[model samples]
Target chain A: MTTTQVAPAPPGTGTDRPAVAVRGLVKRYGGRAVLDGLDLDVRRGECFALLGPNGAGKTTAIEILEGVRRRDAGEVLVLGEDPSLAGRGWRDRVGVVSQGEGAGQALSVRETLDHFARYHARARSTEDLLAAVGLQESAGSRVGRLSGGQRRRLAVALGVQGRPELLFLDEPTTGMDPVARRQFWELIRGLRADGTTVLLTTHYLDEAAELADRVGVVAGGRLVEVAPPEELGAALRRETTVSWLEGGARRSVRTQAPAAVLRDLLAVQAEIPGLSVTRPGLEDVYLRLVGATPTTSEGALR
Target chain B: MTALHATPAEPRGLERLRWAVADAVAAAGRDVAHWRRQPAAVLVAALFPVLLLLMFTYLLGGGMVVPGGGDYRDFLVPGMLALAMVFGVEATMTAVVTDTARGITDRFRSLPMAPSAVVAGRCLADLAGSVVGLAVLLAAALAVGWRPGGLVPALAAVGLLLLLRLAFLWMGIYLGLLARDPSMVVAVQILVWPFAFLSNAFVAASSMPGWLATIAEWNPVAGTVTAVRELFGAPVGTGGGWATEHALLLAVAWPVLLTGVFAVLSVRRFQGLSR
Candidate 1:
């Protein structure tokens, strides 16, 4: 297959450019390339979702951007600075909410947040952070004693307490229940409203659809596609599936234009029973982009 | 949300160092708080060495003989101090392993604090725990008539024992980072027992076989034991053996060398952890 290459731009795009930029980023473990020359751009104040299966190098890419892991080859910039060489001031502007529960099991929720607040010069107050995460009722409870959802909320609160310009949330809602997940999404939206650029990785397609302004689908150590949710399902737009029952018999038709097909169906009968028209969802488009069996491995992390 | 607060007044060099030290102190405070919540674990760890000292000094002291003429408790006390330092390694190992398992180390990595605070905090907290253990053991030893020759020598003996503890702290940090599982700390603990026993902790090297005696005299634990003995004015063998002749030097050298090797290895391991 022929690969088209884009020309590189001159240095210093602008002070008000994207919050994060990655060009030709490559990472390898032993001989296996986890990230095969990836490129990504996350604009300021946008909630960008990175969708990938397990082992698709999503975590590796995020860690490199967070300055926790080094990339073998890349021109990566986070918050207008090279992440690999970013200093402590750069680190202070970036907050990371990782996959696991945080430390300080014995520390109470308020105390844990209070301790972390000291590490940052412009951290939010502990009480306000607790209320934001909906953990005010459990402020005095030890972190070890809280439920998994509460712990994850506390983790998110800690991540944002420093008032970072950029925040990376890696599987942030992994253990949250439906209500908690909705609540967390509101909290993320709040952050975006406050001009915090959020780069999120999640297995939940619904979550990405609800929170992300744009989504990037990664598979086989490569970003296969990136676009808005509505545009991503465009592949399935050419063919529409219509299902209905006529004369007690089930009937279905696939057509390029659903409007034309509906007109024809109406001409055949005055009214059709149990009629329904369906278009592919973001999950369908995502699975097709990643080239996997949509039923079995729709959101499986590669 | 609050307008970024005017860049927050960048800290100076000394201020940064002070922040790092404060971070370590806060982490150590967290560990102390955990100990307070689980007092049983601390009690067991702190009192075990003291109980062993009592059992040995009273039950086994009468039968044991030093190379030079002296009461067994006087000889036993210095060795016990060295034993206490060795014994404390398990606590350090366990604490490090537990922190790793609980994702505490990963949490520390994500924070924007000083990089060395995690291990440094651990060493400081473990040192505090060891000091408590040393004090209890010393009290038990004193109760059993284990007296130093003078006040100055007793203080010197304590200073040497603390030095040995500091050395062991680094060793423990290295081992803790190297071990993958908390259960591996048990294996490390078991390994420490042989190193302690093979030294001149429980008996005189001269009373053992010639080959074993040679090994014991050269053992790093033996160096600390001999140095503490000299500090406490305990009996040093009349013969110009290797341990008595170079007691002070070996005491300092053993800790320095062990700490150097382990400290370098620990820092390397810590860097490798990001991988």
Candidate 2:
């Protein structure tokens, strides 16, 4: 948080710089603002998860940071350069795994990686990249024939082939099976271990809890709250629920003093059956911030 | 912790050019692989003009005659060659639209590659395919008793045909970027056939009505058709007026103009995607 106060320097000249820093970013479509004066900062070597509901300007903010969309007003310094005007040198340092297919349908996995490798000055080997993404077996298969998970893996491979310092993953595991998703988490963990900065956007709250060092919740086109997952839950005023079975009926009470309630219950009962204490989890805090009904399936916190 | 690596400096000057050319060739190689994998589609694209040549020469040729008292096959062969190049617009448009719909174009745009390399690669691939397609049509014409009078003019005629194809190539790219999907491309393709037939590719412009002939004579396809027919020693009717008489000038002018306009439009549309 202290790092954001420092003024951004010229491209490639800043010391102790955040990987991505934005101040008062704004974007509009036909007089309606999609990104309305938002601010965010992602420190180097940290995995920052941006969580938001649909139409909450998450994609717009990410695209502006990636230099794919022009922001109407803002001071954005991504990797020490204004992304909107960054040259190829700056782009080489960043990688993006978009929520879209790769560039070639007829091209095999190897061919596709090789083609993208040429874009960077020091690209990783296609063989190693394929192995990293677990697509070595499908290296010879056309992209059109690969399953959805395989294609997503291929997209990640292409993103990291340049050994980028910053990687942007937008809904990276949308169609992957549970096992594949865990495997992807391990891959991202490896990238983080290598000191690569990752900025992730996902609807999955568990994913955000599991991967992010800090989570920023965006709603109504602005970041309403940002903190570590536990802190985000603690910041919310939701009461802890203490429940137990007493006299053949279940009894429940919401209270801020759940610990005292549990102590009194324990002092009264020699053996209390089916006793449980439930505090607000990350999902509850996220739902509260986004102003959504907890029962809604769309953009589920889980 | 894994070691963090800094991005290497960008390639400068000659090295940049080397990388750009290599990337462009890589893109073209993708088209090569596509052709290898889908040889059937390539064959169909290459042979479609031959079917048109045969249908016109055998079925429609019997009832039609050249305006200047010559073989309809001779006039039709050169004109069909020009028409074949024009017909390639649909194929190029279809490929571009498919790429866009499939999100391939957007992927390419997100990379750090040379901005022009992808389009350059696409143009090179389609142009190479057009050249081969022209050769196949030429062979069919030769088998049907058409002959070139001179080598130099024939080569020049081929150049003009390819130039015309290149112009359509940009137009296709522009339309492809504008189109929503392959279905939209199909809708546009239906219009290409009707547009192709209205030109002076089959019959002489002079043989049509005064107003129709004037419009047909001024059709960009008419310039290439007339220019190629003249170069191939086929009968070119005496369609008067500055536009028809100066067919060669228009042949060159039309492609250059179209290329200038549509290439700008394509690049603008491409760059505007981010905006």
Candidate 3:
């Protein structure tokens, strides 16, 4: 992993305008509201994650922002212009990776990227883009012949090939293995360093926590919470649990202050065996926000 | 990285046209790539019409009397050309249905290309594929001693056949977009088979019963097949009344009308895609 951190741009270095802004957005399908009056703002050069379960309107919101679907009612300003009425120039400034596999299965990896590169005035070189996505070896392989993870990496490569100012990636790593997922995260971080603003929706909670500076949890078509991962968990911080083994029997207790509990236990037992204080993680906060039991992973956010 | 190649200053109208053309070409190129990967399918589609031609000319050619006193092979060739056009509709429909089923259409919608590029490109590529299929069928007919009267007439017949293909392509496009599943396309195609078989493609409309003759004579497929027969110096029945007299005009008009109506409808449907 590259440890060098790119310094954040000075305040007011760029105009204080959002790359994507939506307010009072509503979308309905067959009289059922899929997105009910949702509001969001993604700043320039930030990786913002929209976290939600399936059917929570995450895909619908992203589709409307990409100008691929029309909202029933809303004010959407993508790059300072309404995407519904925006012209070709506005499209040129944005990049989108949809949920499906792209192009025909017969096209070679290089041919696919090269073909898309023609659509933009400025694009990354096909070679460098392929190398960045770790597809340099499969450049001549047919898309269908590549593995599922490779195809996904190619999809992401195509999304960013145009060097778009704003990019929408919906479940970009849905089928990738853990190593590939980590490599893709690094690639996304590199894009942020290059001044690209990204809006993403993912099923992986760890992905959201690791990649997103701020995460928004959406439930039942409404955004319920928006905050940094640590801050989100901060609310459950006081209710910590101290656990240990006594007389060869495991014991656990919830307390407001774990330090006091541990101090008193040590005074009696001299050195408590297996003493440990545990706090809630981002997963705990996420499960709570979505109204699910945190202990069991089943029926949690997908 | 080629240093981003200095953005060229392009004139506005020219730039717009250039982008549209590029998008169309890219789409066509993708279709062709798919065809290359599945050459067996193309070969099979091209062979069906040729086999029909040989069987009709050899087994049924002897006792049949062509209205214009010409070779049965010549009469069957033009109608076979029309059948080729009809048959290619399945390919178009299948392509559209496959794209929808695989979610490729949604992916294309998300791209920044011209709005009409996807459909336009698919139609154009299908048209080109049909032309190739027609040429192969023609080559097989020539080998079987089927020749048109002259080069001019032959080229004119080819043009009319292409118009018919374009008409059916739009119909296929409309149906392909409307059908919910690939199996629905198969069912619709089965319905069209009866229309294709009952037309003037194989036998003279005069041989049919009165009620059936009326339906076959007025059938749009019959109109095209009859018109192509006249253009290529093939035998079309004379006793078919006004339809035989104005077969050429009707042949040209059917495709024009169908193409115009369906193209407009498809474009309108495309505009409403955001819903």
Q: Please report, in order, the local distance difference test score of every candidate based on alpha carbons.
A: 0.80, 0.83, 0.81
Residue lDDT tens for model 3, B1-275:
12232123322467767878888888888888778878998898889888888888888877778664667788788888898898777888888887877667776776667777888898889999988988999999889887777899888888988999999999888878877488987787788778887877777787788878777887777888887787777777667867766778888888899999988887776666677
Candidate 2 per-residue C-alpha lDDT over A200-240 given as tens digits, one digit per residue, 9 for 90 to 100: 99999999989998999999888999988778856454577
Give one digit per residue, the lDDT tens place, for model 3 in A1-302: 11222344554564567777889899999999999989898878788899987899999999899887899998999877677765555677788877777666777999888877876767899999998889999999998899989988998998888778888999999989989898999999999888888899998889998999789888878888888766875666556767788789877776666777777786776788887788777776788787775443221111
* Interface RMSD of predicted model 3: 8.4
Q: Interface RMSD value for candidate 2, one decimal?
A: 7.5
Best by lDDT: 2
Pick out the ten consecutive residues of candidate 2 chain A with the lowest summed lDDT: A293-302
Q: Which order, best to worst by lDDT?
A: 2, 3, 1
Worst 10 residues of 2 chain B by lDDT: B1-10
lDDT of 3 at B93: 82
Better of 1 and 2 by lDDT: 2
Per-chain TM-score of candidate 1, chain B:
0.93
After superposing candidate 3, which stretches have Cα over 4 Å from the reference?
A1-15, A241-276, A294-302, B1-14, B60-69
* CAPRI docking class of candidate 1: acceptable
DockQ versus reference, model 3:
0.37
